[model samples]
Target: MSRELFYNSQSAYEKIHLQNALIFELSKVTIPSIREIMVGQLNFINKELAQKVAAKVGVQVTELEFPNQSLPADSNYQDLQSEEREAHTKLSAALSMDNTIKNTIKGRKIGFIIANGVNALHVQDLKTKLEGEDAVVEIIGPSMAQVTTNDGSMVTPKHSLTSIASVAFDALYIAAGEDSVKELLMANNKPHVLNFINEAYKHCKAIYFGEGSEPLYMNSNISLKKHIDPAIVSWEDETPDNKFIDAIAQHRVWYLELERNTQD
Candidate 1:
């Protein structure tokens, strides 16, 4: 319909047909119930429509008095012409939809930074839980070579630390094992691994440090922060896995970006 409306060569009959089709499609849209509509932050225009919809649905509307500061103090809707008023109503509906949040962690890309001597159990546990939630997990090693866990089991990494940056994934995890942490802290690998953590911290992405991984956390820029960031999960927390999962679902903790970057 939009294409037909903008077509320069469209005949008058075709334009009329497009208008009728658009009107028919608009008319078929179901009027949402008061509960659904109320989920959105309402403005004056939407509030008026909500009252009428509630009445039609046999729900009593409760009036909550609050100042509508979105508009100027001297602004008057009555001053607007018919076309301008219609445009304002459309804009209000679009903005309301923009503010809605969908809570889910499915399909999120999670990166695990590891090295030789990594705790296989630590790697498997959280990886299982996250994968169960339908998230994609990728193992990252200091180099392209295979990583040998503490138990002598070999694990292949999907990416090398220097090959990919923190921006490639939605979140990061450092598994437990003193030997693994030591391997990661080695002269050659330390800077590359720290760069991944620092970049992830700068972007406000969730970072989980398992037991024995504290040294890596302390060395990163995260340790310089003035305040605690909920998205930065440490091994000391009770049920750290649950906390990490919840943080990932919330997406980035953007509100604390400044505090996270500020040094004490």
Candidate 2:
């Protein structure tokens, strides 16, 4: 009877040990699945919050998709990663611009952002110079309605400020005219205009503002005095159009001044 009791106790201990080991192995698999689901739920919640904030600010938010998977199976090629890297490297190398008349405005589309009371003579001269170099020039206005320059010449615009984005143009010119600047500064939804200029500045595009248009820059959200971006050519009697052309030929001017100020 004593021997039988001892054997039964040993059998019970073995069963308990096996049960514990089985539970330990099962937890290893289940815990990671639980963690993965939690992580997925957190990401979804974060994205929903972001979209809500964007909606409040009147901006649209888009989610990213895996680009490689989107490619058609027939068009997909092997070793595309190395080919894409090589293409990008070549593009970066080709983007550098040299200061030369040969580089002058050729094949570039320049936009003259103007309003009513624009300086007709200045616009004419600048347009002539730019077009002479085979550059395309377009007049962009705040509205589709015809605008009369200070000289009483009717100027028609190809696109409105609201319709076209600043990224469409390689360079931007703000014509000289007090009344024009006043209209721009006082217009309802004026930030649209300011935002256009700000976006151009941020993109490092060549920008020119005619003389006596200080109020336009001063009042706008951008503080040009505090931080000047390169390739900004302000024209007056002192600065020649040729100089502006040279600056434009240099393509993008470094945003070092703005970057340094932010760090300080």
Per-residue lDDT for 71-153 in model 2, tens only? 56776445342222222121221222221234656888888988889899999999999888888999988888898999999
Candidate 1 has an lDDT of 0.73
Q: Hey, what RMSD does candidate 1 come out at?
A: 17.3
Return the top candidate by lDDT: 1
Best by TM-score: 1
Worst 10 residues of 2 by lDDT: 86-95
lDDT string for model 1 (91-145, tens) is 2222222234637789899999888889898899999999999999999998989
TM-score of 2: 0.59
Error of 1 at 6 (Å): 25
Question: Looking at candidate 2, what is the lDDT of residue 85?
Answer: 25
